[model samples]
Target: MKSLIENPKDVKELRENGILFSRLGSDEEVVELFKEIDTYGLGSRYVFPDVKMRIEEHCNSKAKTWMAELIHTYFRSPWTAVALFAATFLLCLTFLQTFYTIRPAN
Candidate 1:
């Protein structure tokens, strides 16, 4: 099948980044990348839209309100949500630190 990208510049960039449609290992991966950044398939099934929708759903709410709403909806309460966010942030920080701190598998 032909490539899905519409822009010549982006197409060139994808090839340079080794991110072309055929280069993608699976059809699902091709379909689930960003439309603007990906430019490879029918458009992402997730990722970008979810981020945008999340942002839009909150509309003009403040950052703290947004976080609290997110926490209350998916979590239980404001406190729990804050705790969860902190835990996740710390977990990611530790994981990233460990990942980078590794001395390369020599």
Candidate 2:
């Protein structure tokens, strides 16, 4: 099945990164395919799904959104969240204690 890409320039960008357009043949054929794909807004026609899938897998493997990752990790383990909160609270309390305890010499 044919896939789709959101950007046409991604073809040239991928090729510039040493990706060969094997299905489309040599540099000349690849250039022609690129133009056709660009005109039609079908970048995937020249690029392979494997590249897209690999990118997706890599992105999915990491925490793209730090908030989403925090929610997942913290919410999944409520104890850890509570511990982190407690640690933060303790640090704030310590800072306040030190500020109040250290009076300026008259």
Candidate 3:
């Protein structure tokens, strides 16, 4: 499919092709559409589409598992992932120490 950004003037055509504005639309056009809507004096607002935000939101909303979502959030920052691994290792080490101790017996 052609990119909506590549066809800013063909907003209606995109809609006809089953591309909703929510799924695809130019930011400037969206702003203009909101302006037009405001010109009609309707109490509404429009949020410009952001590709990165849309991707993250989709991942968060459609994730089948909480772990998947958590991993996605953690990996968004490299430091968070590193910290997660370190904390997990520390916790496991503590558990191992408590459970598997070498005892000196008579």
Give the root-mean-square deviation of each candidate in angstroms. 19.6, 12.2, 12.0
TM-score for candidate 3, residues paired by index:
0.35
Please list the residue runs of candidate 1 whose C-alpha ends up more than 4 Å from where it truly belongs after superposition. 1-74, 103-106
Tens-place lDDT per residue, model 3, 1-106, is: 2222333444554455455555435545753553444325433232333653564475467545577668777688889879989999999998888766764343
Question: Against the true structure, candidate 3 has what lDDT?
Answer: 0.54
C-alpha lDDT of residue 90 in model 3: 100
TM-score of every prediction relative to native: 0.27, 0.34, 0.35
What would the TM-score be for candidate 2 when compared with the true structure? 0.34
* Candidate 3 backbone collisions, by pair: none
Model 1 agreement with the true structure over 15-102: per-residue lDDT tens digits: 6556664566644454444333544554544436565455455645688678867766887757776988899999999998898788
Instruction: Give the C-alpha lDDT of model 2.
Output: 0.60
What C-alpha lDDT does candidate 1 achieve relative to the native structure? 0.58
Q: Any runs in candidate 3 off by more than 4 Å, and if so which?
A: 3-61, 64-74, 102-106
Query: Best candidate per TM-score, number?
Result: 3
Residue 44 deviation, candidate 2, in Å?
Answer: 28
